[model samples]
Target: MHNLNAIVVGAGMGGLTAGIALQQAGYTVELYDRVKQLRPAGAAISLWSNGVKVLNRLGLGKAVADIGGQMDRMAYYSSTGETLTEFSLQPLIQDVGQRPYPMARTDLQALLLNRFGAEHLRLDSTCVGIEQDEHSVTAIFEDGHRATGDVLIAADGTRSRLRSEVLGAPIERNYVGYVNWNGLVDAREDLAPKDSWVTYVGDHKRASIMPIGGDRFYFFFDVPLPKGTASQPDLYREELSQFFKGWASPVQLLIQRLDPQTTNRIEIHDIDPLPRLIRGRVALIGDAAHGTAPDLGQGGCQAMEDALVLTNYLQTTNISVEDALSRYQTARLDRVADIIKRARKRSDVTHGKNPETTKQWYANLKHEDGRDIMSAIAHTILSGPLN
Candidate 1:
């Protein structure tokens, strides 16, 4: 048992980021995870401008940049490979105060954990229960171990046990009816391109490829598959091959070269936006608070922003812990909820039953200059309780 402190559950990006922020704010912090070791579990993720901005403030920007690929432009194209719209990301970052970087999930985690140091991390400690009063929080782990802190942050992610304990079991995780298969591919000679994110949109399917570090290309595809479709090892390559066969240029080639052993398929799930993310001394962040579709690639970025904003509030306000939690919820709910709605709406448009409607919607999207839309989003994320 320690003195007044902040205890963070889960060593995922959200938890680690919060731990870093809290430590820097002069709070004693301990981060716990059930896993024996923290390894990059899945694949690559694009750290958007908002996420990088917070990391830069933490002085980890240069370290992270050392392990990531800088994206100069994001291009959207039709299923037939017709470029619909392209945006310059460099200037956008200049206006927004941060640049977007793409890197492996492991890379980002490693950098954060390295900075936090091993002594502050507790592995194999799963928080199964929590008790909180106005002044302190006590956590009970699966192994029957116990720890207490002044504040308990539930950054356990979408299926967070802490969230379930605080809000009761979530209504249910809504499945979007499509599964995404993602992995890194060795960029073919002809496929190798410089600093760009390319998205291919089809009737009910979409694929995106972004440059990660080195010659490897990070890729993912959202394909319409029946719910609970069990994937087998031998059929991995064949299944993806059939799904994207004859779709467009590079599709066939990418599928052919994909190694099933190295690939991962995940069913997408999201939640209806909630009106609040705080209760008592327990506060939520990341997917635990806002689980959105990856349409905008804002999932991790929003989590990072939540961390930054929450820490900023703690530092700026001389208020009590409960008041800080209230302020954090008030400041974060609307912006994050709006993003959730937007992500769901975009998913419906992209994966709607009607192919023609999707194409039409995309065409309309092309006509709209996205600068203003992006700027509005930037404003919401950067302007927190200060506004």
Candidate 2:
């Protein structure tokens, strides 16, 4: 038990996970969020084995399994509905010793909040600045109030104010030159198999459907577009219909069933890897530290990993707080940097930023028997600190 207090900014996955892990480590945790209501930023998260291990370690294994979607296979298809390659995820699951959970973002957030207790989370408090001395760190809020703690964690996400404070420079988020429209729809066989993660790719566009808990499908469509495009919240269905026009029937059906109100559309962006993750008594975690493209589906998973690893260092290290944080940075820097670079490459390839690379990838998928895909997944799962 550390017997210290932690002030965590942002009540998203990483922040809430940090709150729970720190509480378990005998630290009083206070979580603050800018939004009045803590709405999850995404529709669903694909919890790979590494992320699931963190939840299990937090004593939510059964709860997560009960609520998470049971994904048995992963299949890739062309835009015209022709099967490109398919593989059972069972072998990868066995190799990793844990199952992946494709869960709704709201459901996962509710679970974390239940575990960490909603009473400890303070909403409608936006963090504006941070100040720290040799003894403690203080989080300055926009509401003319401040909170001080033994340590402060900046998990405030991609546009983090604390990041600049920690690094002493204003960081810019790079536009990935694509737009993603995502939403949840009722799960039906005609749309996609309830137990499979399916993707349709062609013309530098991607449409994916994954079964989520409660008999629903989490779907996303990716398209190459200029950055800073205005969101068409009211006309999402119409835009999607046109964007994916003349594709497969499953995609059309899914689009037809989508409710415009629930569909979320946003331009994708990510920050370059930070030179460092800590300054004084403040440390950055999750998206604030290393935001990346969602092409690899590791964004939230990496955040969960951040929570567990940071907690482990704080609880197990007998060293000073600053020393422990430096250790955390040392342990995380290389892995996250590699993931960021890989995700960037993947985004480029998937969106046909380089037409030759995209063509090669599609060509390779035709002959892939899933071994190469499974090996890639296995390598990523094995590279985590948990292994």
Candidate 3:
């Protein structure tokens, strides 16, 4: 096992976690990312109990708890300041046996980078292509450097170059029909409850603020928009105001308090679940394998799940690496596919893709007691491999 080498492309959560797990299992690991400096793509990640369990398995539970926000409740609000429903998440925590940690993405990435050992990860090395034979696989970089190993992992993300290579065709990215603007802001009780994830909903749009580390809040605005909606610098606040006009006071405060310089305006998109996650010895993990809309807050969680599943399958030293990868896909493909589809459906509902469903959901929220929401989340957590 010590002689075996694993070449991992992309140093995102999934990639870094896999490298650490594989190294722990006695593989000499080669981790690479195309970026010159590693940074998270989003402001924060809502690490549900399932993801925290993965980090706990990797021995980073304490570190995560330290940086994580104190999110004990999820509350829904109408656009005009009326509370729709609110409930403590204690039952879900008890059901899942772990508390959810909604933390800043930068903090999580830095922790992972530190845990994975920064010296071992190769940065600014863009992996352009991959070559594999029955015995080995090679990752070819754009700079003519190549890393060959016993197995290759493609975790490069939604725009993964290696994903197209594995499928032997161009990958199609489907627009989820909404734009997301997300960033961090200094936490203020007037804007949102410091320990709660509060979302304001109406007119097929959402303005949400969730607690994050360091007394800051992770804020995001979602609106159904035509693809290719133009974004202008210095106008983000005005643009948001127009969209969320007449919303709650807190939503207004969030728009005013957040810094436009650090805010990210992104077109939300997700790839269809691939027909396969493995091609010979090269396996796709994370966004590279199954990119999904963020509606379920499980995008990063699923990637963490991928890291764990891949490592588990490869732990048995006697089995061929190919067989392990095959097993990994067999265990992961359907599960991830189900999640991706479910997330997409959620996006549709949240963004009013089907007006009737969205209307009904809004009506139902008035009488909701949070049982259904917690139950759905608990089901997702318990269905993971660790359970």
lDDT of each: 0.79, 0.91, 0.92
Candidate 3 local lDDT, 1-387, one digit each (tens): 346799999998899889888877778999999999998898999999999999999999999999999999999999998999999999999999999999999999999989989999999999988888988999999999999999998999999999888788988899999999999999989998899999999999999999988999999999899999898748999999999999989999888988999999999999988999999999999999999999989989999999989888888645688898899999999999989999999899999999999999999999999999999999888988877
Candidate 3 residue spans exceeding 4 A from truth = none
Comparing 1 and 3 by TM-score, which wins? 3
- Give the winner by lDDT: 3
Off by over 4 Å in 2: none
Task: Report the lDDT tens digits of candidate 2 across residue range 54-152.
Answer: 999999999999879989999999999999999899999999999899999999999999999999999999999998888889999999989999889
Please give the ranking of all candidate structures by TM-score, highest first, separated by commas: 3, 2, 1
TM-score of 1: 0.92
lDDT of candidate 3 at residue 141, scale 0 to 100 = 94
TM-score each candidate.
0.92, 0.98, 0.98
Tens digit of lDDT per residue, candidate 1, span 246-314? 777777777777788888888888888875788777888998898888877788888888887888777
